[model samples]
Target: MPNSSANQVSVIALTQIGAALARKIQGQLPISQLVLPEKYAVDGEQSFGRCQFKATCQMLFKTSDVVICIMATGIVVRTIAPIIKDKTVDPAVLVIDERANHVISLLSGHVGGANAWTNRIAKLVKADPVITTATDTEHVQALDTLAQRFDGWYPDFKYATKLINGRLAAGDRVNIYIDSDFRGIVTDLTGFTEINEVADDRFDVPLVIISDKTGYPKRQNSIQVIPRVNVLGVGCRKGIPYDAMQAAFVAFCQQHGLTWRSFYQVGSITKKQHENAIHYLAATLNIPVKFYSADNLQTVADHYSQSAFVKKTVGVGNVANTAAELASGSRTFTDRFATDEVTLAASRKKLKVDDS
Candidate 1:
């Protein structure tokens, strides 16, 4: 199975039959089964057997990516209400009947991925996925979900959900402006206008802008979806704190007017592969990390700002600039920016689409 730690799922069962069903589901999917002390059976690193359901659900709801409760929906709802805070940060909650006849997505249907999980489980168990979200029933896609699917990000999600999808749900026209030809990222273009540029006077209708430009199309009703086109090359001292690395990167982006969400991936030297801070930063940003050897970095060294000290210490003339070019497989988009310990640079990756 894939890394269970990365995509953690907690399954809680109240009855023996439910526990049996939970085990079956866990065997099929990459998940950790949580059962009472008396019903503990599965033994492995993946099993979290012998735990209180209410407490486990409360804890996992905050920590796990998704939570599956195989019991009465009412009981799961009442247990989690006290701890629930924001739908954006909350884990997807799914409630399935003990008999495995039905699967209902209870909370965070879109942003939290509950709706998708419900459909997957329903298919496996031959049960109906009861999705209560209006957008799913109305055949209107959620903007946040679309952003995730395209490896993009949007700010003010609540406002976008309320304004953009709301207008579409009411049968209103919505305009989408992309600086480049990226229509292939979107599957449905039924009620959207694909334009090369958005006019300043086009603020009356809902708009979705996908671009990497510093600043363009300043409007209130427009939701900017930043495409993952830039590669972030990073070089940091060993044992650096994750927060420091993240803060330095954020500051660099702000100074350059770059959107951190537009970063396609993070690149570093292969020696730093075991560095916890690097992995932590990549995981927190939801971006993959690419490692390059000293030899690989040397191939792009001539195109970057070379440093004798970096060459002497790390066997490379430059770390950030070379890694950025190597990661993007293109020229540098901006000059290298450095902090006391961390260095960051960026390169643009061109987007291509078929005309036909």
Candidate 2:
């Protein structure tokens, strides 16, 4: 939310007092404003007109990352009930009292960040946060929060969450096994057991295995967290079809024992910045695409596998390796692989934990 524009919060007020309170809170955060009735509308404020609460909520739910409602709990719940879907995709929803005495996280507390937002608003407005999430109340870290912190992806989160949190609530230790060292993941958190090796007969304890390796052993009461460490540097022939390039890329990762979820980004030369196929692959993987100029790639050319044909055609001996090195700020972790029309290389970026 700080650097990326994808997720934005929307704050809505239903009365003049609520509108005034919303303005005070908005000054402390980045959010869009919506008010009900013409009288409640401050200058430059967007008004939903008379009696359009439900309609406004429907639209905001679809577009906003989080919806902060300054109104009664029952009114907010009834308005959003019909449109409620899966918690993973839904925006965080919070409700505040008109007098700003209590800030309640009404929905999507964990993954959608409603609980965190509630606490933030509460501190700003001098109110109490009514957070009911069991893990938060018990002072234990949530599995989803860990995954977000590491930029890891979880498969079958619902089952994983229920099993892990149930173990924590029952005073059982949950084992965490990470293949690579990641900073700021406090192993000392309550109810967590960091294991160095795979343990036998730990089915009673929930296990969290973090890695990018393929074909890892699966176990009951366990979950896999895929860290995004691999950066893909790609080069393709002009006018190549996206499907062809995508298939090659997938095959390369599969052959190398890498998961697509481990990819942090895709990089390429600036000439391919407008290439539809590269952009398509990036969007499909939900990863960012970074481009570097020929001069930039040339600086790292000595560290890459060079090709005479590529040098003659593109002014660089290697595109994939050079671009990957620039994107990752490190040398290639794996050798460059090539198809007839596309070249792929990979690098691993060091993970920096945010202490703040």
Candidate 3:
């Protein structure tokens, strides 16, 4: 499959033949745009002249979702060496020969999706795809790739992943505990034993837990996969500062042993849809904000604590709790807190496989 997660693709070619090959690759990827030197660029195509290739690459590395350098692997390597970041944050980087004979997954093979894009482009142009990730070659799924498949994320502890993938590569059946909600989503369970609980006895073996909750007792060989399933609900006074709202939200999570990473979106009543503080909090969290009308929230308001003042003002007795329950389609709230100025609540959306 083409890398659907990659919204923007930058194809860089320095030579005439490479430019022509890049054009063919770009034809298959409609989201891709060509970047060629002035001498090789066609009309209306992005072009860079003498001493500009390095700067152009640096820009694309930061802005593009996928960077395909159709030139010598070494040149691309040296150019990106200074700007290379962790695979968790870096864009996928691919190297293709001028003749399009091979598409090499040079960097960020798993987490950044280089391997997937390389395979896609190679298939498009009938080229050999060179993917060297050990798990891929050994026909075992890596922890990072597995998380990506389920729209989840692993911790930044690389040692845990390396140990787990190494065990899988050695043909070991790792014990995995996928939350009941996510268990039905995965189609394959070839080399894994699904465990009901994570006990101390399993620490000796490589263990993997996939859940949206926090506080999983894990050893060095354990991999915790956090899916974006939590939905946040907010209620703040008029013109509440962003700092106050954020402080209260963080406090709420900390008190409930929750982490912000698992939150996918924020919910609020339509009466507070124009509230700047809620919008700012959502932006800082890098998640979208969803607004529901007071009438919608009223259906679930009775199940939660209510305030007469709020009901008189916004036509709903509760905002944070009701909004979370309504937006997540959950029958109840997961966590909630209330203060004179701000109120916060959380809910878990119903989990199911989203093939789209």
lDDT of 3: 0.83
Question: After superposition, which runs of candidate 2 have C-alpha atoms over 4 Å from their true positions?
Answer: 1-7, 34-36, 183-188, 199-204, 236-256, 270-309, 325-332, 335-342, 348-356
CA lDDT of each prediction against the hidden true structure: 0.78, 0.83, 0.83
In candidate 1, how many clashes are counted? 0
* Residue pairs with backbone overlap in model 1: none
Cα lDDT tens digits for candidate 1, 1-356 = 11234347877777778878888787787555454335444454233435455666676677788888899999999999999999888899999998999999999898889999999999998999999876677777667766666557788878777777777666688887766535675666545666766763366777888766566756677888887888988898888898898899888888888876788799999978888888888898798999999999999798876889988888897888888889888877778888888988888775544232
What local lDDT does model 3 show for residue 57?
85
Model 2 clash pairs are none
Better of 1 and 3 by lDDT: 3
TM of each candidate vs. truth? 0.72, 0.83, 0.77
Error of 3 at 59 (Å): 2.2
Tens-digit per-residue lDDT, 1-356, candidate 3: 11223348989888899999988888778787788888887677878888888998888888888999999999999999999988878999999999889999999999889998999899898999999988889876678777876678676658767878788888887998887667777666556777887763366677889887668885776777888878888888999988899899888887877778888889998988899999999999899999999988998887888989989998998888888888788854554587779988888776556353
Ordered from best to worst TM-score, the candidate numbers read 2, 3, 1
**Residue 124 accuracy (lDDT) in model 1:** 90
Extract clashing residue pairs from model 3: none
Task: List residue ranges in candidate 3 displaced over 4 A.
Answer: 1-7, 199-201, 218-220, 236-260, 269-311, 315-318, 321-356
lDDT of 3 at 284: 92
